[model samples]
Target: MPRSALPPLPPPAHLRPWLDDAVLRADRARFLTDLSRRSLGIGRLLLLWAVAAVFVLGWTFVGMAWMDVERHEFFSYVHGLIYTVLGVGVLIPAVFWLVRGIRQDRQVRQLLHAWVESDRDPAADARLRAPGLSLVWLLASFALGVLGLWVAFGAAASAGPSRTTSGELAYIMGTGQILWITGLLGLAKAVVHYRWAVRAFRSRN
Candidate 1:
């Protein structure tokens, strides 16, 4: 083909205007807003778990009180039934929601990566950093794990000598185990976030 008939070339880097600061700021803001909205769903799921845990504790206390006062056979059965139902009803849905949130978060991350790749602007890197767990959260998780283990072991040690009823002891142990598990999960999550943040910082450098 004749040179004059050839397609035009893309504008050179020096010839193109710099991406506007205002536009960049707007893009960053929009990205953060979307992320926050998505994260809110996860927060709600966690909140549900908290509420369910509170309910379980409350019922356990009531059941213990009933046992101490007068162990009615029918009431005992009813108490166990309610506890089982509430535990299953709440935990199952909470777990389901948690899994869904995780999947959604992964999808959002992929979308964010694609967005960054499309722009290829060094300035955008600052805005592209993934959210990580805070120091406060890490400390809280560790503390909770330790406290839970302490409670669980303490109850086990005292149960035999204190002559505590089997039902009450079981409840205490279960609560402690739940707390310990949750705390460990939190700690793991914090560690993952820390590692990811470190990798991102290194990549940026």
Candidate 2:
């Protein structure tokens, strides 16, 4: 095909980083480094969730441990074994991730310093600008957040003041809290993306 016959490229402002080969190739190392930092952010979020899970599990065990023995000797032994195994399994990873996060934070800061000193490509920068998220996703995330809040609090309420710390009730409430918090984070990201998209659109118009 002749050069003139080739299709015209989209406007620079409209280019997407993930979709643009030129952007990816322009600074592959920086892109990958940035991606690592983003991954660390996700890891941090997971760490928070893990902490919450541990707290819930710890209290649930406190309630269930005695209940199990009272309910059935054989079943109590089995429950204790299961709890030990699960606790160890979750704890090991959570600790590892927590330690890793500290190292990752230091590395990210170094990388950020390097990135600041490095030269940048204007075209690539423009392409790296992410578009806004969909409205549907935003709404769905918000709904999930609402549902999570209701589930967490409702479970706690149902347990009554006398049994608020009961194992079964604690598990239900903790699960709900985690769900709502995750949903809330998602909703926040969606809103930010949507705002950015709107701003970009306005700039163009």
TM-score of each: 0.61, 0.49
Highest TM-score: give the candidate number: 1
Q: Give the per-residue lDDT of model 1 (tens digit) for 37-143.
A: 34333463365347436645554654455454345577776775665666566656656765764676566545444443333455555443434323544676678
Which residue segments of model 2 deviate by more than 4 Å?
Answer: 1-25, 28-74, 98-106, 109-113, 133-147, 161-165, 180-205
C-alpha lDDT of all candidate models, in order: 0.56, 0.53
Give the C-alpha miss distance for residue 37 in model 2, angstroms.
Answer: 8.6
Query: Over the stretch 105-161, how does candidate 2's per-residue lDDT look in tens digits?
Result: 555434433432333444433432333223444565577678778988888667775
Minimal lDDT window, size 10, model 2 = 2-11
Candidate 1, after superposition: displacement of residue 88 in Å?
Answer: 2.9
